[model samples]
Target: MGAEHYPPPWFSVAPMMEWTDNHYRTLARLISKKAWLYSEMLAAETIVYQTGNLDRFLAYGPEQHPIVLQIGGNNLENLAKATQLATPYGYDEINFNCGCPSPRVAGHGCFGVRLMLDPKFVAEAMCVIAANTNVPVSVKCRIGLDDHDSYNELCDFIYKVSSQSPTRHFIIHSRKALLNGISPADNRRIPPLKYEYYYALLRDFPDLQFTINGGINSIDEVNAARLEGAHGVMLGRAAYSNPWQILGLVDSAVYGAPLRSITRRQVLEQYQVYGDSVVRMYGLKPHIRDVMKPLLGLFHAEPRNVVWKRKVDAALLRCTTIKSILEETLGEIPDRVLDAPLTEVPSGSTDTFIKAKSLLPPPYTVSEEELL
Candidate 1:
């Protein structure tokens, strides 16, 4: 199928490393059907070397439709091979990771955000990946890196890659990565978000699609960005930390779909079935703890949440199945909290949105010297 046939990614969960795994994605799909989900960034070398164990890394439930597989690496041969190896798994789109600021990725691996410094190579890599797969290819990148952070430099990277490859979609994280010794967690928070750079891309590259991803937490903020002419909004930590609050309203609020009638209890019941089946099939390979990790935050901020979590932690030590864990903790949370449907969507701070809008920089204009 061609890229045009797929739905435009108006709302998506960002491809977080440890958070967006298959277990979490299955849980996410149960909440919102319209929001796109992305797999974790799997290095091409990992894909190539672990071909025998491909299913462990590449396998996802069929319910995760409109899913995108994100791969990271700088090698052309391994990238093409990795794309070919992943083709049979049937991802909707393939995204190249050029934005991760991890020291292990950008330092020893010499890839990730480092690829932004070499747009020509990134273009070639995209072409190679496209050649190896039938699905559309996209790039996820930071606005800039280190001292090279400049609006024109970002535009140059975008222009060179899009002009040379078949890629039309770009997920911009809206922050410049600092390659100097800071931790990846710090990289997410320390650098100021330059949403103006993202909005400027929308103005300058009218033909390409840009998804703004950084500091966007609530569904209200996601809609706010859409209102501001953003092609898409991708949420990271918020979606993982508070799936109920963030994803529960995505279908009705973001996609104009019917409000999902399912409650938190229903979601847990469905997930329980999946957990049991996986435990039976995979055995301890996906230990019950790993399967239950995603559920830890499901009851975020509700009454007795802390007590429920303590029960869950206690269950994890003794229970060998997800059912056992839930059986012990489910009673801690009230039936009203568990069974009630989401009706009231939280209202975001309008003052915060207004302040962000006021900081918007002017749209960028291409220089005549670069036009040649």
Candidate 2:
């Protein structure tokens, strides 16, 4: 594909650690074909030095296309090697990770948010990557780091990088990264989100596409950002933990396309077909759990789903095949899953979704239609 043919992402699923793997991406893709998907972050060292076959990092189904493969590293040569290797796998774009504040990413690996201090190096790396690959290259970054948390510094970083290379698409996490004394979890919360920084980026770099990230939950919020002139909005844990909420509604709400009139139950029926295919291809050793974990979030906010949730939780312990898990929940799978409206969120976060699961257990008391 030519550079002119590349489809600009208007909305994307953020590259999370374990949450956005191929199975989950496949499920999300089924929900919204237009939204760009991201693979979990892979270390460039693993790609260039450690792995003999690139498929270990590059493997994905064709339906998962328009996907972005995010790689992390500070070594220019290794990053170049990884980019060159990944391009032939048909990824629509490549995103560099510069916003991850985890110690393993920033401290131990010397990449991620630490790169914010050296935008010149980032520009140089983007040049190397662009030289090696034909697809659109992008950077996902934080607004600033510990002491460099100034708006001007943010502008400087943007100017230095985009000035040197054609990598104009950027995903900004909208927060400064704290490099010390905090867990990665705290880093996500402790640093206050300054969305103004992102708006400023959009205003200052008119030629660049800026996708704002950090704490955006609902389709309403996504629409607000689009109205505010953001090129895109990236949803992380919110998308993963409540896959149906954002993915289910995004088709009609964000894009002009009509909603996929299919119910959540029908979607699961499709997901079951996908799970079966995965198990048939990779066998039941580990793929079943991989297929199942992404689904725990789908039942969020549905009444009487506790019964269905408990069945899946137990399936993780008792079942080896996706078939068994599907069978376990078959009769229990509520019509609500088939008939529930795909509209606004029902007022709770993913954390609440986790806490509210599994309140009911036993020889299953709730009737199927009662769930409706």
Best model per lDDT: 1
- Lowest lDDT sum, 10 consecutive residues, model 2, at 355-364
Q: How high is the CA lDDT of each candidate model?
A: 0.89, 0.79
lDDT of 1 by residue, 111-154 (tens): 99999999999999999999999998999999999998988899
Model 1: per-residue Cα lDDT at residue 9: 90
Give the alpha carbon lDDT tens digit for every residue of 74-166 in model 2: 999998998887887888888889889989889978899999988879998889888988788999999899989877778778877887777
> Model 2, residue 323: displacement in angstroms?
2.1
| Per-model TM-score versus the true fold | 0.95, 0.88
Q: Which has the greatest TM-score?
A: 1
Off-target runs (Cα >4 Å) in candidate 2 are 1-7, 280-285, 341-372
